[model samples]
Target: MESKILVVYYSLEGNTKLIAETISEKLSSDILEIKPKKDIDSHSKMKYLIGGKQSVIKEKPELIPYDINVENYDILFIGTPVWAWTFAPAVRSFLESTNLKNKKIALFSCNGGANGKTFENMKDKLQGNEFLGQIEFKDPLKNDREENVEKARKWAYDICKLNIK
Candidate 1:
């Protein structure tokens, strides 16, 4: 039986989007981009302050319009950027809103250097789901784009193989 897969992610600096897009293409899965109701300023230092505060507090930001039906997808590849050593507030919101029980989840994150508890946080938020695996990219945007894409492709392939079994 063919599995229905979806790549859902929230990106502030486009690094996570790049990884999500690569994985979506590899899996031939539909993709959804999660957006906050209020936009965060990517260019401002205040963005870090607010994001860090929210992440540390585990605040869930309200999401904007999104139409993906999570129930249709059997496998969800969720991606987010690491902020304050955890997943972004937008991702937190998504997890809080979505019903993921019995779904197979694979997590991925884009980070500058430290990933401190990102995967752990995601797992904590998403209970009662089968976690396939997780992958992390270190400063993918500031580093080599080609290398990052290659890594994402390989990771996606590996995840797909595991899910198939």
Candidate 2:
């Protein structure tokens, strides 16, 4: 059986977006990019400080209009950039607005170092869902691109093979 899949993500510096696009291509799924009503500063030294503070406080930044209905998809693949050892605040905002009860979810993150608490934080916020899988890519833009693409392809295939239903 073919499951309906949606790839939703928030990207800063374009790393997470690249990974999300690859996964969406591999799975031939619909993709949505989460954008904040107010864009976060990516070029400032205080970017980490501000992002980390919002994530720690669980602040849900207002998101721009996104057309895809969460209820229409069977499997949701959420991607985010690792900020302050956690998923970005924009992702938190997206999670807060959408209902994922009883849905199958797969997570992915792009980080410079460790995945940190990205997956853990997402699991915490997204309760009552069947978690299918999680994958992390380290510095895909600055580091090995070909290898990360292969890894993302394999991960997407594995997600398709999951017996979530």
Candidate 3:
């Protein structure tokens, strides 16, 4: 049987969104954009200060309504921007609220610098699911746009081509 896939992501500066979109396009999967009810301005200088603090404290902010049925999809591709060396708070909120079990998960992160502990932290929080794969992109909206897109496309293809359980 063919596997169903969903790409859920939270992107403030379009970096993570680009990666998510690329992966979705590659797999022809559904996409979910995670929006926080309250969000810090990415253009503001205080964004780092505020976002970093929230990430450090592992704050799970409220998310705008998103329609999804975890049971409807067999594979999940979750993407998020690396904030404070970790995944965004909005992702935390969604993950905590959603009941995801016995699902195949693939993680992707977008960061200006290093992905740091982003994937590790997310993996720790996301237990019980079989992770198909994980990939990281650097400034998808800015640096090496074509390369990043190509990488995401190939990665998504490879993951989906794997034996689906």
Q: Please provide, for model 3 over 76-122, each residue's C-alpha lDDT reduced to its tens digit, 9 standing for 90 to 100.
A: 99999999999999999988888788889999999888788988988
On TM-score, who's better, 2 or 3?
A: 3
> Roughly what TM-score does model 2 have, to 2 decimal places?
0.93
- Greater-TM-score candidate between 1 and 2: 1
**Candidate 2: residue 165 Cα off by (Å):** 8.5
Tell me the tens digit of each residue's lDDT in model 2 across 1-165: 567899999997998889899999998889999999997778999887888898788788999998889878899999999887889889988988888898889999999887788898899989999898998889898889989988998988887876434
Q: What is the C-alpha lDDT profile of model 1 across 18-52, one tens digit per residue?
A: 99999999888899999988868889989989889
Clashing pairs in 1: none
On lDDT, the candidate that comes out on top is: 1
**True lDDT of residue 163, candidate 3:** 41
Clashing pairs in 2: none
Where model 3 places Cα greater than 4 Å from the true spot, the runs are: none
Please, what is the whole-model Cα lDDT of each candidate in the order they appear?
0.91, 0.88, 0.89
Error of 3 at 22 (Å): 0.7
Per-prediction tally of clashes: 0, 0, 0
